[model samples]
Target: MALYGITEREKAVTVTHAGVPHPDAECHGVVAQATQNRVLVVFVSALQRVAHPPAFADTDAEVGKH
Candidate 1:
């Protein structure tokens, strides 16, 4: 996961990557951030859903454990 962009209020962030979309296509992986320089990352299959800010610690903990 990588930092793609930041939100308008600067309270959120966006991370993006290449991933599978739906059952058939590749899509832009978008993750929301609201933390530090690394922020947070999430792979969103649906671009529309990325409009919200994603939790960072939860994502970090989940990925970090793995």
Candidate 2:
């Protein structure tokens, strides 16, 4: 993913819950994945030009955009 110089802040914004995307939301998908340390507690607004960050560091590998 670093090959793209992709960062989370520019792509995904944090959300509170699994609500329908707002007109202002930019996410493309939502997935629930397991983590190593602990399960994550945040939601991500997916991006097409870049990949989204894991809800928790060291969770699944960063989820990619479609």
Model 1: which residue pairs collide? Answer: none
TM-score of 2: 0.14
CA-lDDT, candidates in order: 0.30, 0.30
Candidate 1 per-residue lDDT over residues 1-66, each given as its tens digit = 233222232223213211112211111333333332232333333433554333222343355347
Q: Report the CA-based lDDT of candidate 2 relative to the real structure.
A: 0.30
* Ten-residue region with minimum lDDT total, candidate 2: 29-38
